[model samples]
Target: MNTTFGGKPHVLILGGGSVGLTTASELRKTLGTEVAITIVDPRPYMTYAPFLPEVGAGSIDPRNVLAPLRKILPGTKVVTGGVSAIRSADNTVVVTTEDGAQLEIAYDYLVVGLGAVPRLLPIPGLAENAIGFKQVEEAITVRDKILANLAEAASTKDPKVRKRLLTFTYIGGGFAGGEAVTEAEDMVRDALRYYPDLHASDIRFVLIDAAPFVFPELTEDQRAYVLNQLRERGIEVKLETFLNSAENGVIKTSDGDEFETDLLVWNAGVKPNPILMDEESSDLPVVTERGPLMGKLDTLADLRVNGAEGPIDNVFAGGDCAAVPDLASGEGKFCPPNAQHATRQGKRIADNVARSVQGRPLVDYYHKNLGVMATLGMYKGVGRLMLGDKEIDVRGLPAWAMARAYHVYAMPTLGRKAAVLAGWASNLVSRRDIIGIPQSADPRAAFELAANSGPKKK
Candidate 1:
């Protein structure tokens, strides 16, 4: 590490997700005016993904949940680009800009916070038919698509067309799938007012999962309550059934059940960005076939990538992307890929990186599972909380409150949090704004053409 204040050591951070911003804040706190930091990510802003469901349901403006990285990281330089490769040997990173230009950046230290991408499963026509929930754009697209489908259903005279347009399928039983179903259901319920012909009964909402139960984190009693709530509302919960195929509007489940659906949401799971798995960086630890092991042995103390000893010196990694060992589980287990784990990983990695710079002993990652929570439309929900040896079950308003409260704090900045609050307050009394903004590849092309054809006075 460079020990000169006039020529401070350069710190380069890849990816501007939740982990990246948190790491930058902590690093700035420790390094002070001693080190220069630069962050690179494709998007200019960091999105609070917990609010993505709200955006998808049109309960909040998509803009309210995203915080600009440039505004947040004032002292640090923010580069709007994606890191194509990380070369640990020379302590350099190659990045590709939005316009397809490439540049090499050298760093004294590298923090690889490259976050998870939506896991696309191998299902027939899934690529063309299903939408994955990961970004703010996907959420916005979901909002527009659902509303358009409802409008189409209301106006169409053909029974087959109307049925196909109204049927919605969500594949996955985790928080993303559960929350999305609830939010979308609430929006569809509210939208019924605008459609004179379409009743709440006409809209079919189905939640499918390969797992036997919904919300795997919840206790048996709480799980039962969640299932009952969905059933009471006439929402179909298909457990142990996977999505066999979804071609256009046609959907077939693994259990021979078939339906034609307008919307197919694949919230199944998430995998680390595949770019990192390439053979370019031999510094990265060999992961197991299931993408679990960080090193040869699953339980590597101190979060160090195995093979090469001594912290990999310059390069560091954490969050969902890396397999950090969980001490709570005595077995050789990695932490679950969730917001709680990701947030904690950010802190530990930052502290460890700082310790490495100072030539101090590094600490291992160790945390107990805190259970989970899920919202099931409006006031209905279910959850389990692990406090010491006691485990408490919660449902209804408590679960709803937990879901909202956790995410409110999770949202990036003060401005975004306030805007989200305002959106919630307004949504209680008003209907959703369901206008569609069709995306065009050449967004400014029309304007340019119009300017050229316009009558001009010389």
Candidate 2:
């Protein structure tokens, strides 16, 4: 570790999601040449998760939702790799690059913003069939898969095959699942106009959740309104139900209902990044509680890692991977793993780290919940905003506009915001892009086929 005060302190940040990216940007702006920062993540860009639903529905281009890390953080070093192990005791981390080479990076300060991964259940055939909705790539895949299914279903004369292709089943009816299914249904409805054989009534959209209600973030009235709106659009909301199995395109539910679905979307939930729980990272204290937040790094209100004895020296953590205290929510409550909290926590932790480095006092992170918003479809949505002690409920077009405007303002860069707006504007003036590029899933298949087709001509 470079302990010399005369040289710039090396700060190593894990993950390049909203939290990590925000921290690096803020630190670079504040400390300038006083600190050297390095960020390590598997992806080269940060996906604006809030726009993922729109991306999946073709409302926004996939590239617009992603902000390249290196471009945004000009002064920082961005390493595209996955952290294999974190030996924090010695201030070293082993990162496995894409090419299978490993590099050991040492730092004077460490930031844990590794983010979370999809929490998949062990239902039968889920691993082989289900698609996730966490990243930009996943969103693009979902969009393509839906379009492909719709095209295939339109051409198929077999009733069973058509039904299977048209049926889209989504598990877990939280904000992610609810918004995704609704937007997808809207896309399918819009696309059906071009397919003479397909009708709105022929499509089946099922949203199944173990909970009795969806969108737990919304109030009772808002939830009811959202549910009613969905049902009015011919969507099946199976509450208090669980997916028993999804084998061979057959969906078996806890209610004993079985159906076939070619598109199975799994938006169940998310857990902290597995790196925090890996045996190699045993040195870091992790939450052992059996819940959604299990395996997260145990962190104090100041965003410092809580070791067995006390706060770990020169180490801090925030974002989805860290169990940060929700100071505004009273005692024993940790911040939820959402983009809002993650982004705010990132800025706070960055300031605290800078303060600690400059021998100044560290500040604790505290922010009140700003409520939640979800766009049901085009020109339709619901939202609940917290204004002091009072709550304001919004629905329909205004809510949709508010959601879009807020996301645009919150998006990291002006370039990305403009791109997203351009995409939306282009969609307004033109028809929705229903064409699916099936070759994207396997780009090399055509090349490989041609290569194996007999010997080269003399």
Candidate 3:
């Protein structure tokens, strides 16, 4: 180990999502010049997730929503690679680069903010038939696919083929599924003007969830309003219904019902990023109740990972990867994996890391609930805001405006936010760009074709 700490302990943060970036920034601010900081991840930028729906709808350029790490984090050392292994015994981590190069990084304090990935279930044909709704590329790809399906349906005269192309199904009713379906539905409805033969009525939209509600974030009254609104728009809201199989655009529901569709969106749920449970963490610390370190609250703090007994030092964890308890609710349920909580916890983790280095007292994290909002379609939305003791529900354009305003402020930077707003304005004034960039189906076929080609004779 290089002992050139210069009396400053080195801090290493994993992942580059909202939580990781926020924590890094906070640590830099609180530690003054005493701490050396480094952040590692495969990507060099953090994506502003709330604007993802707008990106899918082409109302915002995807580039505007992602903040490059080198740009946003000027002082922190940003390493672009994956943390391949964690050697906890020696307090060192192994990171692998895209070119097969690897390095061992030593840290006095380590924060694991590796965010969650989409949960893949063991259902047959799902890996091939369904597409996930996370990530910027998925949003753009879905937009292109939806528009392409529309074009194909309009050109085909066969009723069965057209129906198959126009049908779309989403398998989860959470925030991701709700936003994806709503934004896609709204854009397709508007783009129908280009296809004179296909109207909104010709398209089929189905939202299926095993749970009995659409948005778990909404109040009972607000949830009911959302359900009724979706029904009024002629979209099927199938609750308590789980998809058994989707083969060749045909889906079997839990109720033994079957349907044929072109699009299948899987937003069911997310598990901890597998990297968290790797060999690096074989003897890593965990939060537990009634331990020697911090008490029951130790396991529930923002960054500190308590052992089977209590708080463990030199390591921290947060975001969707850690099961941080919600103090607001007396129940022991872990905080739901949402952008709101992750962002907040990230800041707290940074502050705590800085404080520990300075030998200062660390603080506990407690937050009140912020209401949830969702857009149904063009000018329609629902919001459930928590007041002192009760919840207030609103719908229609007001809710839509609220949603837009909240996201505008929540965007990473002012400049990017302005660019997104400009895109929205431009979209309102002109036709939607629905062009698809075709990619080669068989990448290796190019090499084969090149090898087979002979020189042309003059």
Clashes of each: 0, 0, 2
Which window of ten consecutive residues has the lowest lDDT sum in model 1?
291-300
lDDT of 2 by residue, 1-458 (tens): 47643478999999899889989999988888799899999999999999999988999999999999989999799999999999988888999999999999889999999988889888999999898999888889888988998899888899989998889999989999899999989998889888998989889999999999999889898899999999999999999999999999899999999999988999989888898898665479999989866899999999999998999968889988999989999998989888899999999889988998899999999999888889998999999888998889999999999999999998989999999898888988996799877679799999999988987788
lDDT of 1 by residue, 183-267 (tens): 8888888788878899888899999999988877777777777788777777899999988888766899889999999888889
Candidates in order, TM-scores: namely 0.91, 0.97, 0.90
The lDDT of model 3 is 0.78
Candidate 1 residue pairs in backbone clash: none
Highest TM-score among the candidates is held by which one? 2
C-alpha lDDT (0 to 100) for residue 405 of candidate 1 = 81
Error of 2 at 153 (Å): 1.4
Whose TM-score is higher: candidate 1's or candidate 3's? 1
**How do these models rank on TM-score, best leading?**
2, 1, 3
lDDT per residue as tens, model 3, 337-400: 6677878888888888877876788887666677777776667888877786687787999888
Candidate 1 contains a number of clashing pairs equal to 0
Model 3 residue runs over 4 Å out of place are 1-7, 279-282, 285-298, 331-333, 438-458
